[model samples]
Target: MNLREQISHYIPYTTQETKEQEVILKYMDTFDNLLARENESAHFTASAWVVNPERTKVLMAYHNIYQSWSWVGGHADGDPDLLQVALKETKEETGLTTISPVTENIYSVEILGVPGHLKKGIPIATHLHLNVTYLIEANEEEKTTVKEDENSAIKWMELEEAIEACTEPDMKVVYRKLNDKLKNYK
Candidate 1:
């Protein structure tokens, strides 16, 4: 199945709370300005936090290009909507069918300009991500296959374990924020 299909199959669309929508809208506005300022080649991306309630483990992908362990996510490409970008990236990287955000508690992160493509050594303009970490409850039966192009491997890791495993400080911050958010959720 294609990325869109895969997302629809695995994740359900949960309604966004008023505050969440407001934050998302603000991000979208900022993204619009960023796109205009940056080159057309620049892209937007999104990711999801797939969790297993029974094990309290979260799904993560080993990004081959970056050589880092991170939550499944990717670029928005031409899609103007950041949420769609996140949904598409999550499905493409994880091969999960259905996913959605956790409604009232979405997180927005602004990653300043970082190294572009690792192999090519190209420089990319700074981009903003209005990330909404979805607390996805998935069964073992649902995670079928992962895309080899984006991710080398996919696995479920305990929140603390995953946080410790991540080498990048930024990624660690994201993980911790998500973990704290998950506490209120439980």
Candidate 2:
């Protein structure tokens, strides 16, 4: 299904997601280039909320740009398949050879505000990420290596530590919501 159809059919888990879902749908209708970063103002992004088999810990990377522990994700770069984007990013960012989705359906959705930051020494303006998150499972036995260009470290953090380690206030809310949803999966 197309991104619009996918988002349209998603049953939101919270009032926040319900509101963000509406905004994302409007953005999808308003801009055709949102699938790529070329859109400037807002674009589609995919996130992997990697968890261990027991669902007790989350695999997170210390983001170089945000200077905080964060989930693995990236811009769609013209791909409509966010789940594939999430999987590809999980491998590239974490160096995990084994990864699988807990469910093929989107696990969460958010319209995230990204502050302007320098990437590879070049300035990037602030923008919105119409983010889609998927629950992914990985073996804790597989070693994780950081993609130095993007993150400084990659580790499996307890769910609470994962939330507490994040410095972004907005992201804390997102993380909390994600963690809360884990109860439903069990």
Candidate 3:
């Protein structure tokens, strides 16, 4: 089995009861299966949850394509370890090299489907994001520089507003889980 098949073997498909189960199932059955057949184009990626020291806020980026506020992350490219992928993507997107987990707490996986490319007008294959979110604490002196190519803007926002601003419901779930995990630290 190839890398894509290996990864897909571990990822669970959305069950029948899931709200988007049909869509996910169809994609998993079709797009993902086909992508698994292609050796050259398969990809895996990760993302991070860069929370502030106060615990009341988290860093987010205004995605250019989606035009919505979202967390900092990008494609893992060749990084085999998903955790390292998350860390690397977070650093690349947010320019925070010293960021580390607040309590060594890692969170769940989030899956998302990549829409068709705007310029190419070709349907992009489904992407399974084995996201391992971390509660990172950074010093006040650490300067933040948003990578403009990846994100239009970046800022620290109140957790509540961050959750509300997220367009994806699964991301909202991620925020809630992160919030719950941080409660013990308070």
TM-score of each: 0.66, 0.98, 0.67
Winner by lDDT: 2
Tens digit of per-residue lDDT, candidate 1, span 105-131: 334343423455533465554344434
C-alpha lDDT of residue 64 in model 2: 92
Please report the TM-score between candidate 1 and the true structure: 0.66
Tens digits of lDDT, candidate 2, 116-169 = 988998899999999999999999999889999999999899999999999999
Better of 1 and 3 by lDDT: 3
Cα lDDT, all candidates? 0.58, 0.94, 0.60
Highest TM-score: give the candidate number. Answer: 2
The lDDT, on a scale of 0 to 1, for candidate 3 is: 0.60
Worst 10 residues of 3 by lDDT: 11-20
Least accurate 10 contiguous residues by lDDT in model 1:
6-15
- After TM-score superposition, the amount by which residue 127's alpha carbon in candidate 2 deviates from its true location, in angstroms, is 0.7
